[model samples]
Target: MAVIVTGASGFIGGAIARALADRDETVYALSRTDPEIPGVNFQHWDITEAAPQAVQSLAAKATAVFHCAGISSVSADDDALYAVKVTGTRNVLDAFPKARIVHVSSTTVYSSAEPHAELWEEAGPKDPSEFTDAYSRTHALAEQLVSRIRPDAAILRPAAVYGPGETMFMPFLSKISKKGVLRLPGGGRQKLTLTHVDNVVRAALACLDVPSAAGPFNIGDPTPYRLKDAIVTHFGRMGYDQVVIEGVAKDKALVTAKLGLKVKGVFKRGDRAKLFLVQYLQSDRTYNLSRQQRVLGISTTQHLIPSRFQ
Candidate 1:
């Protein structure tokens, strides 16, 4: 298969690129940075910008595309987020009009509903006017644009994706583990829906082959893990010292998140802690994987804990 993978340098996108390359597929890695992987035809193209002549040329030759490029952080300003996530998606669709686009979306599109239930593929998107966070708002907008522009595009929404090459959440967890302290919101009892990087890649590949299976689908592990247990299990495998997981009040954690961002901005400059700490630590987000299984014919029950333990 000849494929074009946007954001091939990023964690999820890079994983997909590597997986496709492993299968000996002809891969066109399109992103602002080079994927630096063997057998990948790397092209420099920013999604927010117009489709460069080079990218347009590559897209013409590609059979399918994995659109995994977009802003994943809350640190980006509203303007930058909209430009990259919303406009960026529009540009990709325009550029790859012929390719079967597999869009990597997020579970954040769902609005804050009380008594958090399992989010399904059919759930409505968060109201635009109520958006306060740039990442969720822009991602939701980007999904809409994809559906509008190319309804056949397969949209895969994964939750708290973590694995090798995960620079955002994994590194944050590792850093806090090293400190021997994990200060979670609400005492870390919140159940988290985590999708392994491998499972997401698998789902994306399935989306490519599934005949006429287009639209939003949730991809996540079957087992829901708690914040504290997941952390302990993950860190233990990495040979980190025992981490003391403690939970602060949700209200206090919000205040801490606000203060943490401000203080980090003033002192640390570009810190990753300000990425999704507030929401991940505070909220309980899980998904109903029935649609994912029924549509993709792939279900992942892989635990985030180490191999030997499993």
Candidate 2:
């Protein structure tokens, strides 16, 4: 039997594929572009379209399907997110009816219009339509669909995933830093529950190997990190020195972001970038990971923290 990893070209998906390949698993990686992992086989896949014929044969021998073939762009058209996340999820479910579904969703689906000092394992919002961005709404729709169709399938809702090749937080930090000064909302003190790519892969693979890994699971590192500390550590790891971190009041950050959104189409992802900066830095979205620790047996990776954070 084989493992099918969608979005294998992406950060989290590629990591999952590489981990599986390293473990000598037969991996079929599907993505718009080939991830070029040494041993993983690549197949061209566009989630917007129907499942391709060339890869459909693998389903008969597929033991698991990691549905990770979507993007999380706040500026992405609502219809587009729906097509990729909601409709595309439906297609993946239909195509891999026999395989164990491990859908990789994001923590954004948790309603975050307001600040959260503490967050734990529970369904986030009853109404995703209330969300201003399509990223959360569309993902919520996908989760609802998955839970309805395959109640026993594993659903992983990871917080702002940061590591090598990440498109969100990592890029935001890099793009906004001017010389050495980096300004962030709430002084970047928002203790965000972040998932390292390694932890995410561990949770996903554990879904296949452990029976208790069913239902929706919140996966992240052992602890939450302040946004400022995360940024400093990231830059420091790259040998950056004298990086000055500044904090903008949460209200001011919100105002600036709102103003940026009013500008029309200057940068396609500008709204996404601005909104993400404020929300990630201002909101305190931390989770109680004991559920994942108990279910996934995550104790082994406690030593995975960077030496600096330790």
Candidate 3:
């Protein structure tokens, strides 16, 4: 059976589509731009502008759709982010009513203040009033939209995703490690959850056969880590133990305030680096993946951050 993957040009979307293709499943990859993946049918269609014909054409030949397309960066405007994450999802659902959808979401939709607490499937608070960033807010709204369309749609809320081809944090880690000065936000005690690209792809593949695997499921390595440990491990792997870990909460705030003041005229303070850091530094987000394990049959694996410290 063939599966349609949106945002196949992106990291997570590309990984999931490649995983399916590796299993000999015909993958119809839909994106605004074509990704250079072998053995997959590549199609160009913008979800924001309502690609009904494009979606329908692919849905006609596919048994399932993996809706992995959405805005993830906090640097974009709220309206543009919502259009892609919320409106784009609506268009896809409208075009493919019968196709099973695996809606890719983020664990940030959950309250980050108390991450290690209780993350119950049928329990805990659902709405996130504390989410300050446009990315998380719109993603949460998109999840609501997907649920309204298909309550049985499989929802995978992965934690901070990392692996080869990751452009966001891995590079940052490398830069800081090479400098021998890893300045952590806050006290570096914030518990963070991360999902390997391989594990996330595996979970997406498992969702294909498990019709009962509907609703939101947290997919990540069961082993949560402190932000400090993650950085230390990354540097140590590169054979560098002479690292200085500093926590300058006041300095961070001052720098953020200066940047916010400078960029206030050009961009709203909502998208400022300070605001983004507040969410990252102050919040501790984690997930209980028992539901995912029970439903998707995913076994927990070791942390993906390279273990050998220098």
Predicted structure with the largest lDDT when compared to the true one: 1
Q: What residue pairs clash in candidate 1, if any at all? A: 187-247
lDDT of 2 by residue, 120-237 (tens): 6565644777777778888888988998899879899888777777777666677777887877776777777778778899898898788547777888888677667776776666
lDDT of 1: 0.80
Q: Give the total clashing residue pairs for model 1.
A: 1
Q: So what's the TM-score on candidate 3?
A: 0.86
lDDT of each: 0.80, 0.79, 0.75
Off by over 4 Å in 2: 239-242, 265-270, 300-310
TM-score of model 2 vs. true structure: 0.92
Which of 1 and 2 is the better model by lDDT? Answer: 1
For 1-310, candidate 1 gives per-residue lDDT tens digits of: 4799999989999999998998889998889889798888888998999998988877667889999997666666779889888898899999989889899988878774343468777774666666667788788888888888899889999988887667656566666543677777787788888888989998988876795789998888887888778877766665657778877798777776777777777875744344357555666778898888888899787677556676
Model 2 lDDT-worst window of ten: 299-308
Better of 1 and 3 by lDDT: 1
